[model samples]
Target: MVATGKKLSLDLRVIELHTQTKLAGYIKLLQNNMRKLFFGSKINGVMALYC
Candidate 1:
């Protein structure tokens, strides 16, 4: 029973780390998308000026 408890604790730690990594990746993706959207709108506005 003690061994099982130890294994469960280790598994929880691994899961926590994985979740953090995933969350970080998701945040980065959102930042990148926002940057792209900001720049895209700027470019569109410039094109509209010419059109």
Candidate 2:
């Protein structure tokens, strides 16, 4: 019974780690897209001002 419990706990931990990694990857992608959008808007504004 103890061994089974331990195995279950390990499985849960692995699943948690996988979920966290996936979430982190998605967050990084969102941050990168946001950064690009921010810079793009700034560049557009500058161009508009110059024109």
Candidate 3:
């Protein structure tokens, strides 16, 4: 019974680590999207002025 409890604890730790990694990946994706959006708008504005 004690061994089973220890195994469960190890599994929980692994899951928590995975969750943290996934969260970081999501944050990076969001940052990239925001950067692209800002850059896209700037380019659009310049094009409008030239056109």
Candidate 4:
């Protein structure tokens, strides 16, 4: 039972790590889209079609 408790703790740590990484990736993607919108594309296009 002690070993199983340890395993559960480790699993929770891994899940938290994955969630953080996923959030970071999402933020980076949003930044990229904002750059595209300001540089060459219009907000209309970016917001409507994601191009």
Who wins the TM-score comparison? 2
RMSD of each: 1.2, 0.9, 1.0, 7.0
lDDT of 2 at 4: 100
Summed over model 3, clashes come to: 0
Q: Ten-residue segment with the worst summed lDDT in candidate 3?
A: 35-44
Candidate 1 Cα RMSD after full superposition onto the native fold (Å): 1.2
Worst 10 residues of 4 by lDDT: 39-48
CA lDDT scores, all candidates in order: 0.99, 1.00, 1.00, 0.89
Question: Which digits, one per residue and each the tens of the lDDT, describe model 2 over residues 1-51?
Answer: 999999999999999999999999999999999999999999999999999
Clash count for each candidate, listed in order shown: 0, 0, 0, 0
Where's the lowest-lDDT run of ten residues in candidate 1? 42-51
In model 4, what lDDT does residue 5 have?
100
TM-score of 4: 0.73
TM-score winner between candidates 2 and 4: 2
How well does each candidate superpose onto the true structure, as a TM-score?
A: 0.84, 0.88, 0.86, 0.73
Winner on TM-score between 2 and 3 is 2
Candidate 1 per-residue C-alpha lDDT over 1-51 given as tens digits, one digit per residue, 9 for 90 to 100:
999999999999999999999999999999999999999999999999999
What's the candidate order when arranged by decreasing TM-score? 2, 3, 1, 4
Clashing pairs in 4: none
Clashing residue pairs found in predicted model 2: none
Instruction: Assess candidate 1 and give its TM-score to the true structure.
Output: 0.84
